[model samples]
Target: MKFKVMAFLVAMAAAVPAFAQQAGPTTDLAKLEGGVFTVDKGHAKILFSYSHFGYSTSYGLFTDFDAKLTFDPKAPTSSTLEATINLDGIETMVAKLNEHLKTPDFFDTAKFPSASFKSTKITVISPTTGTVTGDLTLHGVTKPVTLDVTFNGGGTNMAKKYDLGFNATGHVKRSDFGLGAYVPMVGDDIALTISAEFNRVQ
Candidate 1:
């Protein structure tokens, strides 16, 4: 038993260095690859929340989404992005609520089907932070919105692909998009948060 324990400990010690050598994304812009990248859907998510009658906050998210990013290392402000979210993919973790959200009272997935955003401007505030102004189309209405974005990191992943990660937050008036169902009772202002990872495709 002593010999077996010793062998296991030795093997575990040897693996530590290997694990340490494996690199993930980093917060270094100089190392980021400049090109077109596609969202790594498996590593990305879009979440939204709103006040519920001032009692609590209700949260939900869209699971099926895709985005394409155009990055320029030399001129970061020139970067742009386009994304689409399937309205039918909304999830609140409650089966009935999820189905209700798809009804006309809320998103009305049958009519809109999807929401999309196309960035019109990218402003670099610093090495790792910026703002993105874009046209957001949701619930059959289009409006301009700006999102505060942070460049979380960039690096080459284990798959040998250049990966970049970002976090963005924004707010929109639900009524502006014709999504006002409960109004003040459910809240008209909606907050959106997005965390995504993009893998270089070009």
Candidate 2:
């Protein structure tokens, strides 16, 4: 009887750390300050590539974007992310093609000036990776989307400011969001890639 009890206790102790790691640490949002962070537009990029004309491929980037990341990384699950991308900022290699993309046939920038994403839930899958499920509004339509997110580490920059960086990508069907202006010509699937840099408020 004595030997069995001792073994049971030892086994329980070994399992405690695993349970703790699963729950992760909780961060206090009130203790952390919030501020505006530059996306490092040069280093950061938002690009989407898709098949065109059934035989060729095309890609574009939104030249203008802004985002606010509010959270304590130590308590990552509690973080909130809000981002806005100007539809009119879409840039293709050719100037004329860029202009055509913003018209009603494509993004219809006049009707939907911008696209936005707001996080509804963030789950940490590992120390360096996680998933962000949120609502992405595009073309005047809102739909739930999930982003495969990777924590790119955080630290102080040359400006003596603390910042956090992340890279995320996901896929969405443009037609589902009312952007289905094309038929079999343009691919229905749009791949979204985002690299965001957020600075901590002092």
Candidate 3:
């Protein structure tokens, strides 16, 4: 019995090297192809955080969202992005807090059930980073916002199709969208962090 267990462990250890060589994304931006891409819902997320009275930070996320991308790897400035997030899907990890956030004092999910963003311009800063300026509509108000975006990687995904990934960070003032109920107490500025994966539209 002892010999059998030892042999099994040895075999598994030997397989690790081969398993690590499996095909995956490449960081080479020059190798990417330009086309339309749709979000891989399972591999994307939108996270928001805010300062809580200078003591701690509160975090939440919108689990139901989708995005479409018109990409141009050669001429990255021509790329465009558009996304819609379901405000009702916001999750704060606390059941009671979740309910409260949907109230009129906060998101008022009952009145505004969704938010949308449409890119107006993209300025490439490097092969792996850029700035995306767009109109963000939330809680019945629209404002111009810019996000600093980084190209994570791009290549053929496990599904045998080309895929692209990105990480972005930005911020907005709650007052701009009429969601500033707590103001200096809860927080007026909201920080947004996004991680997303997009696959070529086949």
Which structure among the candidates has the greatest TM-score? 1
Which parts of model 1 are misplaced by more than 4 Å?
A: none
lDDT (10s digit) by residue, model 1, range 14-56: 9899777758766666776789999999999899999999999
lDDT for each candidate structure? 0.91, 0.78, 0.91
TM-score against native, each model: 0.93, 0.78, 0.90
Which 10-residue window in model 2 sums to the lowest lDDT?
23-32
lDDT tens per residue, model 3, 36-80: 999999999999999999999999999999899999877889889
What candidate 2 gets wrong by more than 4 Å, as runs, is: 1-38
Supply the TM-score for candidate 1: 0.93
Off by over 4 Å in 3: 1-23
Instruction: Write down the worst ten-residue block by lDDT for model 3.
Output: 20-29
What is the C-alpha RMSD, rounded to one decimal, of candidate 1?
A: 1.6
